[model samples]
Target chain A: MTRGFPVGEFQARLARAQDKLANRELAALLLTTEPEIRYFTGFLTRFWESPSRPWFLVVPAQGKPIAVIPSIGAALMAQTWVEDIRTWRAPNPTDDGASLLSDTLNEVAGNGQIGIPSGPETYVRVPQADWQRIKAATKGDIQSDGGITATLRAVKSSAEIEKIATACDIAGRAFARVPEIASEGISLAQVFRNFQGLLLDEGADWVPYLAGGAGPDGYADVISPATERPLADGDVLMLDTGAVFDGYFCDFDRNFAVRTASATARDAQARLIDAVDRAADIARPGTTALELFHAMDRVVTGGAGGSDSGRLGHGLGMQLTEGLSLIPNDHTELQPGMVITLEPGIETGPGRMMVHEENIVITEHGCRFLSPRAGAELEVMR
Target chain B: MTRGFPVGEFQARLARAQDKLANRELAALLLTTEPEIRYFTGFLTRFWESPSRPWFLVVPAQGKPIAVIPSIGAALMAQTWVEDIRTWRAPNPTDDGASLLSDTLNEVAGNGQIGIPSGPETYVRVPQADWQRIKAATKGDIQSDGGITATLRAVKSSAEIEKIATACDIAGRAFARVPEIASEGISLAQVFRNFQGLLLDEGADWVPYLAGGAGPDGYADVISPATERPLADGDVLMLDTGAVFDGYFCDFDRNFAVRTASATARDAQARLIDAVDRAADIARPGTTALELFHAMDRVVTGGAGGSDSGRLGHGLGMQLTEGLSLIPNDHTELQPGMVITLEPGIETGPGRMMVHEENIVITEHGCRFLSPRAGAELEVMR
Candidate 1:
């Protein structure tokens, strides 16, 4: 079986999903996105890159989840815990997967309501035309199930936490070798390539998201792709990576000075680290995401530097960024088994900024670090 | 500017889009997907990895596109050709860019209809709830614009083709060095890591998709991730990659024999190459995807072997797979300035198969190779 986790893990997940569906008085849950489908069946494949086809998974209120996917994925799905696998030759303009998906949903739900994720941070992977066709064919009310699914997915399993921790360790090992590959005179683009290579060499299944910037005092933004400009003395270089291991992601970054550091950059880095420490100290089973945001914002701004970045941090798991964002409006309560990132950013100058991030798993009393703790001061590369 | 292409390229694209919208009587076209937004405004950023916020671009019938996105992306979007960039602090539960996007659409569209891609191979990137909110708040009717957008994106510009060719060349260079990294004693997982590192070293901006399978005679599937199984003598290994260069992707793969090859595998490889050659010879501006599929299918099946793989080939450009698929049901005509991939898979045994792929750009007279041609014989790694 190519699926990474044991059958019990997927079974527990399905059970949780079914419980949520039952609690919401829904007959079944329709999952079309990659993360939702992979969560219940453990049917993992990189084939999702090709958008030519859409895969569907329907979880009933009482039984095991059924896979309604293309025939190309049958062999892999069979290796998972799913038993009732229905498939069709995909890219069929006449039928596609619409008929099969509709029939499957109708069989499970009959005339009852079917839940699907449709709220914030959720996207329906199936084409809108296909979704309309399915809706017209099936006799069921397709209600928004984002609240139910997000509540369940927010809590991670032990196996998932271990996988995330392993990914963090791999990234840490790669970041430790950045000094050997990055130095003055090396282009930031080349540095990105070398750093990504090091991440893969250290044991990441793949490096999906890598974005950073390099500037004299600090970077203007943290999301821009590396430019070909050569690194110079006194430049602050930041590299953030979302490396994967067994489908789990570790979202974090490390900062380094090319030859020397400005006092403003140093002070910003220290303040960001302090903010993370304060956030980590208050991250417990009962604190809300908004509360945690306030806890970090105090140290980051000190009533001066307001954050322009959307959120301070977010929940992390199957996707690079997941539920329960650390913003003022989000009231999602932190609970045990929830893995999240504490990312605090500070503005150093008019067009310069520094951001610090770390991954942690919330426990009964507090939180434990998944990623290795970064140093109090910024490290020098040359 | 951080935007990749010149203003003239984007202006041309906008002109094409406006012509399509005007012909369809659409007051404005709404784009939310990464590829769609980047295609129009050249607003390229890796921040799309985070799904916390939604980014929107609204193109009027006769003018430039307006961007209503997160404030965090204002700097990068400013670097693009888009002049009217509206900003908001994102991950805001109360109004997550909905009001801004709705207001922008209303300003341009009035009470007329707005177009959005809603057909096959198209996914709405925004949350369904937010989309509903926008539809309720705006005065325009949101209708399907997939046919228009797909038609515009199907044909590539000269600069786009060159980027894809460069990415292909980088992959070819990396594949040529496989013998030095892959051997009988090495695990397939390590081989994948080394191959991706080589692609980066060869100037590929990033490798988005790398999938393959290793078996005695041939692999059962082509989309499976590399396992830790050590390669033995007489095993056939296939590696397919989607490497990127300037947001353009090269989609192709290569097959290699570990030490010695089986007769069936060798014959299948030769036949696959022959199929590609036949398809390439017949490819021209007037041909159709169905014709190309038949051209390759005849060489692979020989009126005997039936194919289960959905499509023989698909269009490729900004995405790993896009636009028209070389399937019997699709009748999209090949046109000048269109780039596509010719992929043929042959079943060597009951459950084992080998597939070959190459990228080409359709020219005025005939098709020109964008990816370097593969050899008739399968390469041996020993």
Candidate 2:
């Protein structure tokens, strides 16, 4: 119970999930991933880092969630709003809570279909053998929830938005100090370490993801860990972070030029900013993710844009990245209270690219920035 | 790419995995988890943070692994020893690398059995729907590997052991500086942040898991994130971290007494140290994990010990925690080159507990400490 919102907030989320389940005529929804389980009940713990045990939460179509977890988590899960908790000693290869899960699902489903997430970006955390065992033991028709829970998790609540915004502000403060910490002759690895310390000092609960690269014009890839390569003049250093605050993440990055920048890098940075602005104008309730992607693409390529960096951006909350990716094929309708990142990347040269990202919350009219806007000119760290 | 061992290291690992597959008559091993994939090909990247895409590496019976991953990861994976990399635009709901994975598997296996991890402490990281689709597309017998890969991954090479030792040393240096960073009037959250900063400054690539608690006698649980509670006299504060170095983890914790310690707390600390000593004496190549557990249990409760913290310790490596739990039911025989943590816990009073942990590498004769041994008495911070 490190971070607990008002019980009413959890109740509202549970109601939303139950409504979705009812519409699908599903008897229950079985959640296994961290974000989905934490969405309904406030059972938060870093113990999920240990994959040794599987924790399960079953949301009945009508009532509250039932937690079938290891006894070690019983004390922590008891702190949550969940009441019906069944515990067992975990790491038990013979059973490993499968019987308890089956018994609980049987009691909850009552011959109706059970919905589990099996679609895009979702994985069943339970062991495959145990999942099969539980399926054989239970009597209900276990079917894919068709990403119902992910669709619900896409829209952030006010509290979640506040947490994510706080994370963004923390990372923003750290980014503002990049010039002082990153300089010539300092290895990129040392710079990465110093920046992570700054993020922690600025109030990030944890820095889960920090990836960047440094090169002459621009970096080759944005998802690389730092190397011992020292920063030199005319190098463009980009640092992207997914810093967490109270379990919510702000996915954004800032680029800094070592002493100087090339014209291509500066132009790419400006174009990325312009693309974000264009996307922001259309990022209102009822807009589809595809529409937002096209808006940004038009600005990035002067109406000839196509995909770069695989995805422009994606939904952000609870985890570093969540559902409703801002890609062309994703037609997820944006609504008020949905938090996302407007990230636009452009190729500066043949194998060199620059990416700019900003976190935002979709509003009734358009969008508001969570992370402070990057400068039009690339930051120079001399 | 960031931390590449000799290419022969990866070759040796692939050879071992292939040997395991051959023993089980599995034509190919499909790895989807971070540690497993990184183990065979040295394809290390923090891009695993985004669950949006599934990365697969197929280790055939007699050759190098084939990486069927998102196109965005192509550049980074190219840096690794992996050669045959197939890429696709991921998040493509129409396919999402399923067809590509099927084609690769079909090409590699050719009606032979494909092994996937499906036993305890393992989960398929791919989308359940996509896995089903791939299963339907491919003609191979996709069977549960039954912990085949995990067992192979449990034994570390000398190079791997060096990385773990380096991570342990980094955490040890940070723990040694705790007196300067944590004390009375500083909130536990601040202490967590400062200590994580210290870990980075010391040389940890990233600190993925840092959890602890402070209480009058001892903390109720050790898996909680830091809260805003301030340290005061007579409180026992503990910090456990899983800091990573070159993708290997050192899982250990240190205890500090604020100003003074109660007799109960002091006694509990002594018992935990004594239990660790007894367990260390028996932590050799031939002893089973259960026997090691019993050795520590005998000292903790005079032959009547029961569970206090779910597990005493577990296997530590690429992930925060892994296979081979030090529990009574786990009879996984300790072998030379296996690295594990010797964690001993005792209940000082109702709703209060203290646990001590250290990392070790099992050797041919006995075991050697990967982390500096904790002090005989809990360090007091004023």
Candidate 3:
């Protein structure tokens, strides 16, 4: 597969952003986060792991996005469609691209509204001090982009959907190999480590997110890191991974019993997959995310709200979780290109819960699973 | 190795922060970033990869830190020493813990000044909309933490140092096995993918950052993601990684020649190691980060100045790159227990460059390399 998007893909994305800008009468969008900058310019790099320097991309009203970044990134940014790349010797105790970014904003927009993605799940990815400096120096009114950024990114292109599907396939293959590394007496931490290795071996570029739990009947919560607790007979093991393939993530999980599967655990497993199916069946264009959540909530919680985890699942793509959430309040209509995770958690006991997730894309016909669909029966590991 | 820190380690950290809070007369510190929250509470998890929910930790002047986070994190937070854990059903379209966090802050700090880290390399990790709402609702005077957060984090404890050293050791082992995964005909992207697998085998909890390049003589830049370009016989390859172990990061890189090394690349490699050695020779409790930079710069760039990576290296611990930076302007004095990476870059030829990095920790006497030190000679791949 190609490393990054084609030039036309970026051009189409920019045209879409420009359309939003024209409609809103906004001058430009000042993007600071990785996904935002990358969505417009195809400037993908793992260097964002370092919080040392802040990178900025300004999408003007009617032109290609301009990159104002650390000088270290000039070469990589040059390879992308972003031509107006401004560089600075970063960790520059004084300015650190704040002035250059503000100047670029003024030059692009000039006394108009320079929008920034400022709704939920959108952070101004700059130093708090530097953000203040950039805001003070800018001639334009720096305000929230009014969901324009989120709206543009919510829907996925065909190419983006393919990448996400490929990621799901890679994770599916990795999940198939879990029994090789997991069994009774194997520590959960080792299973997690081996599962990540399996992801790399199965064509994942990297595994960004991996969290699960193993306990009798069910696990406590889905967000905790793997502990050294060894697997035992009748204990359930959950391995959720957000493995990436070309910057796209497949967020899903698989459950297995160590040696023997309990009737209650098996039933919960069946119900979890039923929830995913229930949600996917009605997840069509014009359907709301809240409705999908209700479909899953009905199966998992028996129409009793949901687990304390809040949302059942969420929008997924460039990030493990993004865009609209599968919550009661989120009324975002499902779009043809929108990809989401149907993650439903069910309480098996007083404090034990089982959560299952699957990746799917909303299509003209209906919702189609990107991930290899899981069966109701829980596999017992040797 | 232990999964999380002991209660005493967290207690000591809280005591240190309380001292800083008392001295500054700041009512409390509102921390949003992973490292900041993890430092005081021993609450470590890779769940922060998801941007769906906001997590907050309020460090009051006295008493245990209060955690105002999503209900999903309640179980994990309970595992830590933190007692006052407040939860909100997150993705709550109206308020994702904004009111709860502000209320917690007000209860802890009263109407006094609440601090948030605002200096260089410090970002307010909350979403922009939620941050504004929290600021608007808080009765306390919200402002920059002055430098209290940075000051407290710069100096590490014995346990923190040990974890960092362990991470360095894991990376060192992974680097040693590069020959097993890399060779003249293999693509750089494959090498990157395999190297991450090696890191997991070498005992890293996760490989968060891995960026490198392979080109004839030397790579153009160090921050670019690996391309599909195959490594040629005359290529010089560098693999930089920020591998984590128990939440501590070891930020370092190693250089390798594919089959054979060019004289220019060999010389650059030698100079980079010499620069690291020079920096370590004077990196003691009394030495400043500026002095260390000058030492390394004298050897790498002959005092002509460093590359665009900004600083040659910076402080390292809970995060990949954090706290003080090694630049001419940074005058922060080194203290015992301060972990840092001594990285130096040089122009091998016109547009080509090479960089080498080694993790080190300042001691009462001098700097000691935490990462298994690389020799002056570049290892040629088979």
What is the lDDT of every predicted structure here?
0.88, 0.88, 0.89
DockQ of each: 0.74, 0.75, 0.81
- TM-score of every model versus the real structure: 0.98, 0.98, 0.99
| Cα lDDT tens digits for candidate 2, B1-382 | 2366999898777777777788899999998888888888887888898988888989898778999989898898899888899999877878889999999999999999999999877888988888899999998988898677888889999988999999999999999999988888889999999999999999999999998989888988887767898999999999999999988999999999999988888888888999999889989988998898888888776777458366677998988888799888888888999999999888878888888999999999999999999976878887
In Å, residue B138's CA in model 1 sits off its true spot by 1.1
For each candidate in turn, give its C-alpha RMSD to the true structure in angstroms. Answer: 1.6, 1.5, 1.2
The lowest-lDDT stretch of 10 consecutive residues in candidate 3 chain A is A1-10
Candidate 3 lDDT tens digits, B8-73: 988887888788888889999999989888888888899999998888999889888889889989
Which pairs of residues have clashing backbones in candidate 1?
none
**Docking verdict class for candidate 1:** medium
Residue range B1-382, candidate 1, lDDT tens digits: 1327788999999898888887889999998889989999887776787777898999999778899989999888888889999999988899999999888888999999999998778988988898889999999999898577888889998888888889999999998988988989789889998999999999888888998888887888876678889999988998999999878899999999999987887888899999999989989988988888888888888744236578888999889999888888788889999999999998888889899999999999999998889998888876
How do the candidates rank by DockQ, highest first? 3, 2, 1
User: TM-score (0 to 1) of chain B, per candidate?
Assistant: 0.97, 0.97, 0.97
TM-score: model 1 vs. ground truth: 0.98
